[model samples]
Target chain A: MVEITVKVVGQRTRRLKVDPGTTIAELLRRVGQNRETVVVRLNGRIVAEEERLKEGDLIEVIPVVTGG
Target chain B: MLRCSFCGRRAVYHRRYAGVFLCDRCLIKSVERRFRRAINENKLILPGERVAVAVSGGKDSVACMHLLHDYCRGKRCELVAITIDEGIKGYRDESLPIARENAEMLGVEHHVVSFREAFGATLDEMVKVAAQRSTGLNPCTYCGVLRRSLLNQAARELGADRLATGHNLDDETQAIMLNYIRADLSRLYRLGPGYSPRQGFVPRIKPLREIPEKEVALFALLKGIKVHLAVCPYASGIHMEVRDFLNSLESNHPNSKFMILRMFDEIKPHLEAAVPGFEARGCESCGEPTSSTLCKSCELLQGLGLMRRRKNLIFVEPS
Candidate 1:
């Protein structure tokens, strides 16, 4: 299992334990979030939800947003 | 590891739509290139022309302001930031400072226009009044009309040669889709990177038209620009649904967003001659160009009873 700190910018930060390699999509599903409405960032870099996260990874899920 | 399409560096963004992976450097270059190309191809701006950049302090508009400022430095054009405070209470109040900060940082002259000054009411008040009357229009629709009016009036008063907005490919595509669904051919005809010149109206331009929303945000991030991150409190309804739908479609189909935009561009030229010429006369109440005797802003205000609804549309011929 891998321990990673998850932080959603402008929202919340947490630490979680996950399998050796878990995709961001699975993490979002576990958190009960709609993948289409959130941007997954791993270690300060935007990544696809399909990105496989690693131990000690810092993850952020930002809501899908743009200005009018 | 995926490599940048142009550079040998490790890729940061894999644009499935284009089948290209870009690193931070290459990505920035690509975005900037698109920005310049949109302007050059569409002639959105001419040398020495002053552009009033509408900034909402969001990543999209702020990125636009910064990009245009940099682009204008060499092109000998001038940029001024125009931000409209829709008076959404918690919303506009929070975003204003960020707009000011970015304008100050860019050394561009900033103009903050308010609904209170223009229409004697904040959007929050407008919403309350509208709800009491049970108006058919949504808050976003009212706010959009008012904001567009104020932006244009401010830009025109400032003697700007053009008014530039930060609309991206996603925004454009969503709008196109909406207009298409509504069968609003005239509105669809007007959707493009640059709006042609019309008397009594400052031409509007969108230099970021070719870029995607996510990339605009990433460009802002990579440029170390600070922008307001909060979404508007009233951003619910059809627009949001359309945005979500298009986003999901893009995710599944990759280049679907670009395909929509490209398709619109192809259709726009054919629409030019077919779309009937529109002529605007001085609005009876606001004196702005309107096919109706009263401008949309004035008509809307009249609905709020903020202004007396003059029976002027009867005399005004359709444009």
Candidate 2:
């Protein structure tokens, strides 16, 4: 099992152990994060909810925003 | 007498969908036909270009995606589905799943771009801050800026040749009214089914520009597309009131919206020649295309500290 740590900007970070084949959507729901209110970036690249996470990936979940 | 599902007026015409009825007046300006006409008139899709449909899981967008997919099939154009997740909590959450389902069912490639990591803020956060600072300003002003910026960037990054939206007749008319009210002739001139490509920017095409809102709803129903039928929680207060006023006027005068759009079309030629080029120039700050040194999206993002503010915000007077 690949251990992945999820960190959200302006929020707390959490770690989870899962198979490398886990999709971003499943990981987000597991972390008690709302999929609509945030976007996930894996290792500095924006990954869609349907994208799967690989081993030792550092994921950053950001929120959707608007202004100006 | 049965009333229309849309306006609750006397039902005057039968729609293709069962249990759906439209007034004779509404049937005349049906959304499907309007969309077909818009595409025909504007030459929105080419023979072999890959087109990306922007879906928001709303009726208009879902209808647009389905229509474009069906229309482009034999035409040899590829249709990909793109959705922008604005991170509006419950509002955007429910819609994403529906959009994905629609894309999957259609067997089109689907991509989603979000604002969370892109800007480090959510729609909810922005609205909260805007409410505190600018009490009366509309949230759409911000949402529109961000969504357009992110969508354009995402589409380009995804290698889409053209970006398609579900902006229908009512939206075009409302925008025309707002532009006229603000004397924003430049923007008014730019409003249409197609936006010409400028330097460093990809072109955007709207196949539903001439379709009415009601017709879009009908098309969605007839096509059996599941739409996220919820109003944006932030679209209340003054902005909703303005839309309500316009809708009431449109209800009373069935052709009023189309008439307004016609006026815009009539004036477009004159405005195009007179107005200086609305080309994309590299942003001095972010290197994106803009009418000025910095693009509007970057300017707004910089204002929120999501991006570094490279240049001072220049407020152009609507000439």
Candidate 3:
């Protein structure tokens, strides 16, 4: 089984490993993320929630922020 | 891979309205350039002026502070951070530290003003009281009005020439549409990027108004700026719906958001004569500038019985 790293790029970078080929949605769920509240970047590129991960892929989950 | 239109590098963002794909460097440059252009085109700030950026510790505000700091380099203008702690226990308490952290990182002076100190109660306490009294208004209504008022007051007291907020394109367009739906012409006129010098009120400037919210988020991440990711608990209601609706529409129509903002801009000038204007007055309670008998903050506090609470309530019970 291949492993991918999920790095939450928010207040603190919380890292976790998950099985490869995981959908961004599943990755968010495994990482305890709310899909509606964040933007997901797979490796260096922003991707859709349904995008699948590959082995050794780095995911950056950033919170969606608006106005002051 | 979508290549950046400017440079032959892998694109990090696809700006739909502009129909352009940009690499990280190009995107950041574009955002910065546009930010400066927004300020320069509108004459938002003059040389030798101080700008107080309202930092919420969120990516938008933190990123804004950093950008403004960069823009202030080698110039007579200065940038400072002003964070208002609304006393939202789980929400704001978590974000306040990051605000200070960002300010420190950017080497800008940071000042935190709290509702507890300024209004004699935290938002948590105020919300609890409002809930107890069955107040129909949402927390955001009171929070937004009071926060804006306090920001203006604090900025003015800090000797700032302008108070800058981190309102991006999505927020601006969503606000414009919401005002249209509610037929709030006056607020609609106030939704643009820069405010003119009004009597007794420090002008508010929004440099990020031309940038998309997602791009701003990506820009912050690319720059490694630390920001609070959690959304406010009271961010629901009609505003959220309007935001979502606009997002969906923009996803299909691409540039629909920009079109709406442009339309609003086109119509805003004509609205000046159409909408009835009010002469500014001073609040009877606090002497802050107001359009009515009492300023919004005082009126809100009066409704919440804070005016009464602010009085000396130290009673010696039959000692």
Q: Which candidate wins on lDDT?
A: 1
The alpha-carbon deviation from the true structure for residue B205 of candidate 3, after best TM-score superposition, in angstroms, is 0.7
Clashing pairs in 1: B17-B255
The i-RMS of every model, in angstroms, reads 3.0, 16.4, 4.6
Tell me which residue pairs clash in candidate 3.
Answer: none
lDDT of 1 at A15: 91
Using Cα atoms, each model's DockQ against the true complex is 0.37, 0.01, 0.20
TM-score of each: 0.91, 0.71, 0.85
Off by over 4 Å in 3: A1-38, A44-61, A65-68, B308-319
How do all the candidates rank in terms of DockQ, highest first? 1, 3, 2
Give per-model CA RMSD.
5.5, 16.9, 6.4
Identify the CAPRI category of the predicted complex in candidate 1: acceptable
Candidate 1 per-residue lDDT, tens place, B71-122, comes to 9999999888899998987878988999999999889989888787777888
Residue range B1-319, candidate 2, lDDT tens digits: 4466678765533332234656544553465576677777788877788888889888778878988887888688898887888888887899999999999998988888776656667777777776666645466777888788777766776677889998877677777877787888878887988986685556899888876565565455444579876678776554445455565676445566777888888888888776777666787876666788887766676656566232221122578
What fraction of the real A-B contacts shows up in model 1?
A: 0.12
User: Relative to the unseen true structure, what is the C-alpha lDDT of residue A57 in candidate 1, on a scale of 0 to 100?
Assistant: 93
Worst 10 residues of 2 chain B by lDDT: B308-317
lDDT tens string, model 2, A15-51?
8899878887688778866453354567765444556
Ranking 1 against 2 by lDDT, winner: 1
Q: List candidate 2 segments past 4 Å from native.
A: A1-68, B1-31, B131-137, B237-239, B308-319
Candidate 2: what is its chain A TM-score?
A: 0.82
Off by over 4 Å in 1: A10-19, A25-39, A45-51, B1-3, B308-319
